[model samples]
Target: RAIAGIMVTIPEYFAGKNVLITGATGFMGKVLLEKLLRSCPDVKAVYVLVRQKSGHAPSARIADMVNCKLFDRLREEHPNFPDKIVPMSSDLTQPELDVSREDQQTLVDCINIVFHCAATIRFNEPLKDAMQLNVLATQKIMALAHRMKHLEVFIHVSTAYANCDRSVIEEVVYPPPVDYKKLIDALEWMDDKLVNLITPKLIGDRPNTYTYTKALAEYLVQQECGSLNVAIIRPSIVGASWKEPFPGWIDNFNGPSGIFIAAGKGILRTMRASNDAVADLVPVDVVINATLAAAWYSGSQRYTRPKSLLVYNCTTGGINPFHWGEVGMNVSLV
Candidate 1:
């Protein structure tokens, strides 16, 4: 690996190139942003799409995000890193992602890379909300990418479980259960009650609306990318960081992290799962690294785009070192 510390080509590809990222404040998004600045310090600018939340304006949220614990090392090193993070007001659930005319124009003119990370992750999110955020939002972003003058590559973050309806998962986009357009049009007339009533039926053998829509989003990406280079990253059961951006860096208490924390604190907890069953838990940073590398590969040949779609399924299976019982024992000892 370059003789133990040589600058690599991934960073070189990003050097002086403007990058646009949605979901910059989310868990994986934060790590991706920090890594881009820390590893590719010469990147021209990172335009993050942010919408007002909890009474905080887009700019305020961006400021707070850059100053979070995640970016401590980055701040210590590159004091001017904040200058490179430009916040663009946006709401993915709205038309055109709620991005302003001027901002849209700016991105169209200058953006080199686009990372679509914003989505409704809540498993219980309503069907209508899920469709708006997951499927239609993808289409809106694709529309924006089509108009970009300097766009090199578009990276879409999807879930590994998106194709859970299948017996065996492969590194490819499976055909969606239903036509995205017909369903979207149907939802327009149906109220939440109607949508919820038929949510399970509509999802059809898929576990939740989240996975169901993600599958549709993948198919939509393939259809809408047109001539733009595109790549998709499917990460399963993303957990805390293994290394990079500091160890044990995680804010959410989901999956294994939640179980261990509650168990350690003597919170009344009993769960059902076979210890021997493989947990496809992958580190967030590892996913980010794979995503960045895929971006480079997608746009390597700017003129002649070789791969129209690069799909990466980031998950752990087969033989694995650790298991739930072993991990639980260690946490209890602590």
Candidate 2:
């Protein structure tokens, strides 16, 4: 979007900036990683923190991710695109995130932006596990961000359902039901059985531990962000791409695609759901775009604004024009 030959500020801001991303292997994480590399071509480098998965090392996982069909468009544009990604070994569940001393020092010295995208997305995740990944890991990341000397902005990819207990969702970070400090302490001493036994009562009105812990994580971010330029992007029901890299681009069978696929194939018959409910499904690319733009703005010109927490609810709100045909076809048949 060059007006008189000047590059657009959003892409321009990302130029020459080193980025550190957590959860670079998840569904939305893959899209975010790809989009950052493709869109911000001149960006210095992308450091992705990855834990070993399914007997694959962090480096191997990163290679598999870049080689996936999702990066076909990106690979065509830049044949050596994979060279820009540097996978750092780190596990979110471990103490201090398992980030080694040298790597931690390197990140502190060179990282310009931090995107904490990792989280346990399971709807039925145990309270202890969810709090560990979503809340405790976030707390550790915030501490790490505080140490980054060149950090310009920190963007946390949160779910729109973080505040699902509310009837009307707002962009503001709502007050969490429990104090994260107390919860963390309790989880340390409390047995898994006890936590599971109290899960229903702990989550209260929320459907699962996912949302409850996410809400706690958001609150922790809000409290810990301090003077850092930070933005929390809460995307709802992120589905396939609308039209960035490609249309109908989805990697996983989780989320709405699973239900839609089953119904489309006449496998899922008469699933219980209200037609009147708002299915707030957002595209993965859209969320990535918003996240990029938000970082640019948060880092560039928004410094003068009263450090008010910036939260973006990136969702269709059940009223988008792009969704009717797709939903009508997939869901109506069921």
Candidate 3:
């Protein structure tokens, strides 16, 4: 069944719901927006939480967001997508995220779903910087969500690499390397230079700050489990899908996208990774679909469940295994 112009199995479920999504300008957020608009044309509104950057207002940021190539297909289908997609100014790093009282009240009054995809995803970010974005921002979002009168579900996006130190990953949240609260307290008193000097010792064997903070954020979500309906999605090395939208279409060379694009041009010769290890690249559209499905799942069972939180390991290792070398050659040839 199709509802509000979206092709979905459960059309009536989200036909006219007001949803709020953070990280609207990110890679996956763009795909999620396209999917929802194309499938659910009847959705009442989508309030995107974006920061006021470079002195631009929230509306201006949204205007630029919709004009991006990611929304080109949506524009073709509904040339006036701006009418449904609304951007709300917010700074996740701020104490209260800089969300005005009016905006907060607006969200509480209307929002039914919240997708928290905003976070600093840099692999080399400093400890303090990473915590500011990944951990503190999450806590602030939860605080706001707790005040929502009509909030149904909050979906937090986390990386599968949060537990990369383990040889095999599980579907449950793992204990972080350090006591998160203690770490935060220490960082609060320490100078930036002092924090940087001890980052290596603090993080231990973790490859980078991104993974370290994400692990802590997972625990933070657990602490708020009693109050908020949340789900944590851990996606491993998200890559271009084999199908959907288009194959071989990718933007940015930060993650495996870099390797794929490099291999395509035959410029990137070698890289670091266990050749035989399973490649867990998931498609953007697939993850977005799973996210929406999870939201619906959480919403439908709200009464019976106890402010539930589900953790999904979005990996293709057990079902289908592709090696890095195989992907390299495949991208090079086919």
Query: Of 1 and 3, which scores higher on lDDT?
Result: 1
Q: How many backbone overlaps does candidate 3 show? A: 5
lDDT of 1: 0.87
Candidate achieving higher lDDT, 2 or 3: 2
Instruction: Report the alpha-carbon TM-score of model 1 versus the true structure.
Output: 0.94
Cα miss at 92, model 3 (Å)? 1.1
Which runs in model 3 stand beyond 4 Å of their true positions? 1-9, 305-308
Q: What is the lDDT of residue 178 in candidate 2?
A: 85
lDDT for 21 in candidate 1 is 95
Score each candidate by Cα lDDT.
0.87, 0.87, 0.82
TM-score of model 2 relative to the true fold? 0.94
lDDT of 3 by residue, 203-289 (tens): 788899999899999999988656678888888877765554555445677777887777788798778887797777888877888
Model 3 scores worst on lDDT over the 10 consecutive residues at 1-10
Per-residue C-alpha lDDT of model 1 across residues 1-334, encoded as one tens digit per residue: 1324443488888998999999899988999999999999999999999999999999899998787788999999999999999998899988888999999999999999999998988888899999999999999999999999999899999999999878788788888978889999999999889899999888888888899999999999988788888989999888899998888889889777787788889883666778886677888999999999988767665544455577898887643446665666777789
lDDT of 3 at 247: 58
